[model samples]
Target: MKWFYDALNILGGISFVSVAVIAYFGKLYFERYKRKQDEKIKSLQSRLDLTNAEMKSKLENINHVSKAQFDKEFSIYHEIWSCIFEVADSVSKLRPVLDHFDPNESREERRERRLQAFYDRYNPLVVAIESNRPFYFEQVYKLVCEYRDLCRKEAFEYQHYEDYPNFKDYWESHEENMKLIKEVMQKCSEAIRDRIYSLTIIK
Candidate 1:
């Protein structure tokens, strides 16, 4: 009976030791797993932050480039409009509403002077349009070309005014040319306005 008791006591002690060992190892494994999970979370957060920062930078760069492009386009458009206005003014001066007869200037001389004035403005307009050809829409470019052609035709007709039978014939033809020019100018202006409106919306 004594041996049996001793054996029982030894077995109980061994069981206690085994449980303690298992608990200690289990605690260590759990702590290690928790630490690994924390490290993974930190790594993922770092990657996400880097991605966000890069995206922000790229967006800012794109906006800056878009703004610069828009400004350049606007400047070119302004230059074109200025040239058009000058051409319009020259057109008006070609046949003044109130002619001041200078006895010193012959009819041919007056025609030459008016044509020269048109050329002065027309040349600049040509340069502006040609230099920025790529910047204009096809329709706008065509309208400008049409305006140029009309001005040239007016100049040609005025130069050959002596060919006409009477002043009435020449004046009537000149008025018609002026009317066509005015209409084209209006169309061109409206086209430009529409283009600018579209660009504004995109911006």
Candidate 2:
């Protein structure tokens, strides 16, 4: 009976050892599987972060371009109007002094010099507008072109060398045209300023 009891104790000890070995290996396999899953999760998160950053950068670039384009267009419009105003003022001054030309060659020479100066200043502004014609807002550009062309025609007719025989006939109508120009320029300036304000305040 003692020999049988000893054999039972030995079998119980062997069973316990087998169970411990199986549990240890199972824990190790589970830990390795969890580590692989964590690594995959980290890789996916990193890729998502990179993609989000790229998208943000692209949006900012687009916004910058839109703002810059608006600024450029506004600057051109301002320059065109400024040139028109300056020339109009000069012409107004000259118109009053037209009948007072000196009897000697000196007055004619001075008038020629003044007209030449006007041409020199006016030509460059016209060229700049023409050069940037493609970027202009069509309606605004048409108005600008009309204004410029009228200015050119007036200058050609009034220039000392080309002196129109019917200067008095056109002078009265010229004043009315000047008034029209002033009104148009005012409206255009106001419209552009309003648009800029609206855009800037949006965000």
Candidate 1 on 1-203: residue-level lDDT in tens?
Answer: 88866876787865776798899999999999999999999999999999999998765544222556667766777887788888888877877768776899998888889889888998988888789888656677888888888887887887777799998888899999999999998888887776554453234
TM-score of each: 0.63, 0.52
What does the lDDT read for residue 128 in candidate 1?
81
Model 1 alpha-carbon miss at residue 56, Å: 29
Look at candidate 2 and tell me the lDDT of residue 175.
Answer: 69
Clashing pairs in 2: none
* Tens digits of lDDT, candidate 2, 90-136: 55544453455556668667667667766766776687678878865
Locate the minimum summed-lDDT window of 10 residues in model 2: 194-203
Off by over 4 Å in 1: 1-65, 200-203
